[model samples]
Target chain A: MTRLNTLLLLALAVTVPLSLLAGRVWIDPFDPALPNAAVIFAELRLPRAVLALLLGAGLGAAGATMQGYLRNPLADPGLFGIAPGAALGAVLSFWTGWAASGWALPLFALIGAAGAMALLGAIAGRGGGVLLFTLAGMMIASLAGALMSLAISLSPTPFAMSEIVTWLMGALVDRGWADVWIAAPLTLLGLAVLLRAGRSLDALTLGEVAARSLGIDPRRLQLLMIAGVGLTVGAGVAVAGIIGFVGLMVPHFVRPFTDRRPSSLIVPSALAGALLLLVADCLCRVLPLAGGELRLGIALSLLGAPFFLHLLLRLRRELA
Target chain B: MIKQSNPTPSVRVERSRETGARRVSTTLDTNGGLECAGVVLKARLADVTASLKPGEVTAICGPNGAGKSSLLAVLAGLLASDSGAVSLDGQPLNQLPAPKRAQAIGFLPQSAEVAWDISVETLAALGRLPWRTSAAEDAAAVQGALAALQLESLRDRPVSQLSGGERARALLARVLAGEPRWLLADEPLANLDLAHQLALLARLRELARRRGLGVVLVLHDLAQAMNHADRVLVLDLGAVVADGPPEMVLTADLISVVWGVPARWLGEPGARALLPG
Candidate 1:
């Protein structure tokens, strides 16, 4: 099963790049065709596709890491406050006009994610279980959502509101290579940290006491996992805005394929995530909705939400 | 019955250097074994002091509120005590890192809850975490443990699909794969049937004798404890009331005092006392 999953991931990694190359074309064909095509392919489509892949992989891998670290199957960065915290930070930066420069938004987003995770650690420390953590995450997410709404409502210009709305809806449109470069390194670094913590994650499956008996410090592992997820999800959201369901769905879809071992699940989840995002982006490009400029987030949620619900129901039945 | 001779096979025991009052600890010769002295464990509630020797199945029999599990936890280094210390072969257990401690001790908690769905072999390999050895070595150890526990056919099956007894045996395989010196089991026979209960006790005793491993089990069943344990410690509330051979510790008065149940002991010499209804 693991072998088959690895093969599928390898195939997707190759195909995604080829698809990005084939799909990129100049919108304005009549004005100096060859150079325009080259510029469009190099500048816009290539970077956007790369960003999609990176962000997708980051969120998916982070989600899997968080789930394993927490020993909770339902955990994901999007549902568990990391994405919303990052969104809040970016929006706050944008509202303050501090992130007018290139990298400020992502930097602040990472800080916000770190802050949220720290808060989660504190809350979870006080005799709280996964349900409590989930509630706390939901509360933080809702609070962030309200703050974002207030920021949009109070903005002096319609242009700022429009930008915020587009971000909230999520889009890979008009992203440059510079944005991709900014987010990619941070996300990759987070993935590396998570992979290193894989063995600790396996120990954690047997509960905190057993893990400790096996010589894993559960508290330290938890903190490291939170940091890793924080960095990746923060950078991901800052780069691509709020792309939901990829983190939540990809891990579940890829878990059985990896024999449900956290050590083997990380890379597969990342690959599946990248593929899911790339395919969603491709559909966004070709779909007739909104005159072929549909938001990738919308396309993703449309496909993912029902599947997520179905999974929840199935889990509920199994537990019952 | 495979020549049930003296369980403690005398081998070359390496003795650790002692300072003044503390005695030198003995190491297992080829076979796995453990030796502890002046082991004091303190928790929020109480303190416990005891010593465990190799090649004996010792049952820490106690009431519900007794510090049996806590003692096990301290010995396993899952919980750090306040003052008194534990040492394996005169080496301080506290000085060793978590991984090294794991290499020397195999702990089976009363209940092990796992969320991930994985095959039995994969689960058993988790025991090799402490060894930090190669995957091939881990695989071999897991296979040996599985065969020892009669779980060869269930190696590829998911742990979630196994019955409770099967799961317990699979988990036992995971712990045994570590090849630790001391086996610390908390209520290992809690949910097993009569046959499985006897089987588990027999297996533990066999391991302690054949491998020279030190076995310390926290047990609630007086009959099982009396039957299988070479030595027994009876605890009530938070203190040890009696400690010695099973015949001496499993008395009617001790059972009545510790368990608050009307019971009697009936046995001949070199036989286990039966508790009748």
Candidate 2:
């Protein structure tokens, strides 16, 4: 476990500097002729890099926890509907022209996330099993997704419609230190919560009844999962729109290196997740697309969908 | 004819005092292994009352839908009975903290599943979840458990790669790592071959005798119960029909009345087989 952590941390150290340097401006530290290089580094790249680390780490840890809870390697935090719910909240802010006011967009998204979490908890009820929880989350995701579509169709103006669409695609363009401040603590807090659930998640690997007999309180675990996924995903949607797949893919990448225990997967997954988003975001900046920079969310999905397909095929082979 | 063993509290007290002085420090309670009074779980279990003692292998035997598993679950504190109470070592089970209760009682479900591709050692180490002990302590316990199950060679192997008997042993090793005073299992031998079943039963009997563990198993094979278990508790529907030494309690008449099968025991004592007509 320590070896994996050390390796990932070393990789992160290398990638962070590269990510900051490899962007559109490409500021060389040795060059004396460059103007506003420090400004570009301080004001623009640093916060974005920090934001990537925070959100990616949060997403990765969340994915590991989710997979552990469901006992399915393919399980993703998005299965809980918190991200979609947060996106719906953000979409409403734009639809009603309230996003023009500072903080209203994030506030609305967080509210939406809270609503989804509350609904999930209520529907799951007491002594509810993982299957029941998954079904409830799927229902909430579908409901939120439909509501988001309705909001898009009823946009106040074409510009508002376009803005909402663009934001929904998810990016880190023009994100400032304010966004970093917003995500830092919430993501950290979310990671802490997910890590706290790690031992219980490991117990769950023996199935529900065995886990309970091992002192795992199902209701308490459910609460931790909801809160942790809610904070991380909701905070990401609030700042960077709807970035996806970091949570889904990072755990898979790190699983082979660890002991395959749920608790052991969390930290390494987080570090790898941070590395993945930073590298992906840097790639989006330099990819030379004709229609401006590609959205981070779209970029990940482009990479993620194929990865997902490969995973499914491999699973089929294993089962066969 | 069935012979009922009378409860002798004074004799049991004196025996407990002697055993308590000789028992390992990890054994949490010196008295009252596990007791359920008037436990009722809707239609599944009805007003079941029994007291199980440590250092004995007690087989809970009954036909399908006869509430054997339910009684075991209640004893393990996994299922709350509708109206009765399950106590461990004279303490009301539900009132105790879950971690403390877990430290004392290890339960293996009927079809325990390993959800991840974790190593056998890792899976066995999961029993230390309640203790959260030092790494050295955890490793030692896991090692002991693996050794007991004859899984030391397979410790590094993944659980998915294990054979049926090996897998069952690995799952039981997880329960053993906790060093629980009570070990309760539901149909633990159902999926194993005859040889594996006999091997596993021998290990359980040894643990009960050597470590003073209270071993309660819901068994479907009557002959196995008759041969391996020191005491047998026979259930009909949801109540205890017979509870005593297996030789006395598992009479041919009790078998016919409970199972609706005219089964007869053949072969000498300790090597008998059931022949059903």
Candidate 3:
């Protein structure tokens, strides 16, 4: 591991524990006859923190894979409409009051994401050009957004409509072990597949003919990477709704520290992704508010968008 | 255009600028070659049959769109032949596993487009990817290739920061790090200055002779091909129009027929040189 990797890993280890700590419902490290407190910590705070870490890592890795595979800095798995599709699925569950049903929302969300990708492929035809890519993404996001609104409008009352709308903005509040179980396996599998794309992607930078000559079959690699991105982003949106910029920004930040080799960046990007989200979630926990914690995605965007602008200005100044 | 009625083996080394400094020749052993039989590839590549032998550099020269790149792609197993067979050694090329094929054959396309602005060391190390799952051998291999291409000083420099010729050499070092038995390059001399082009060709020739490596290069510059290649394979309209020792194969008539410019040859005694009129 490089010095940066070691530092990132250390940061991640500290972040996760810090994330689990400082919640409103606090449990003493050791107290007689406080077994119920321990159960609450295990069943509630720990699962939420773990879910946030996994979701962040998944989105980050998937984003990195999409960017690397397409050779585009702006290609976000969420922007590709998978996250909107997932949000739509979760909205449908909420419309039908399926939020109370364990894991049903995530399950429906995964299907929605997969279906959106399939639909995107059918509409755009194997991602031919940058225009088609953006067009397909817009179409899927619009359709999913429209459908989510439709689901809310069809709800029994204004309360249900508001519930689905808030959920759509993205959150990790009230999550449990069920959310963790639902997302973990698929996210890890997706990450593994994406990481495997490092070598093929490196070959691809040499161009199509060269990559093929280097013994990397681009067709096979593309199929595997796209599927991996879909699964990862799908699982993340299923649990955390639609956290933006973590995917798009984390890789950009981590890339400079890495060798800039697509594959080598995956692990570090994932770690940073996990840490970034942990900080955001932990901030949500630690901040005192009369109306409980702020929504996770809002906090992320609030922090991330400003940082993004700062980076852009710095980049421009450097270029200038 | 140079026409040689009789050519000598020692003339190959005598022609190069680095005549003596860059050689530790092996016994000139020759085997493990690629053979294409009646192969028809993408629309660009038609029925082409040729043999590339180890321990010698063969230049595939032709006018633009003469299937030079397509032929090399087919040989590298990047493209499947529509008809006929290409065998590495004796086994069918497609049947070879990708990792094994990568180890045996190194291919460099004309474009040196690396998406990331990575270090030269990291970029060169990519050529050793097939063998990377093993121990720390990749570092040594990367170093050896960088040194071989005379890019040791630029190893830590970012590829984006390197000059045009330096970037070209870095990409070449990537291919060399693979330690392939057969190295196929498409129009590698493009964008290089005269000095670097000649130096690269000389280095390739030395590697072929010393490492028992087979090299097939698609060259637009007929003059460079005629001077460097042991054998010249000329393609016209997707077929091998001429194939033999460079001295025997290259002539004003063939050059005029393929390139469509009337030319005459003036040869020197030191080495068979081409001077077009």
Predicted structure with the largest DockQ when compared to the true one? 2
Candidate with the larger TM-score of 1 and 3 = 1
Is candidate 2 or 3 superior in DockQ? 2
Give the clashing residue pairs of candidate 3, or none.
none
Q: Candidates ranked by lDDT, best first?
A: 2, 3, 1
Encode model 3's per-residue lDDT on A83-123: one tens digit a residue: 88888888888877877777788888988988887876665
Docking band of candidate 3: medium
Candidate 3 chain B worst ten-residue window by lDDT: B10-19
| lDDT (tens digit, per residue) of candidate 2 on B1-277 | 2223334311110100111112121223326769887776777776667878888899999888888988988898888877777888878899999999999999999875999999999999999999968999999999999999999999999999999999999999999999899999999998899999999999999998889998999999999999999889887777777787887778887788788898899998788899998
Off by over 4 Å in 1: A21-35, A99-101, A118-143, A157-159, B1-45, B267-277
The model with the greatest lDDT is 2
Let me know the TM-score candidate 2 reaches against the reference structure: 0.95
Best-performing candidate as measured by TM-score:
2
Question: What is the lDDT for A249 in model 3?
Answer: 86
Runs of candidate 3 with Cα error greater than 4 angstroms are: A24-40, A96-100, A117-157, A288-292, A309-320, B1-32, B267-277
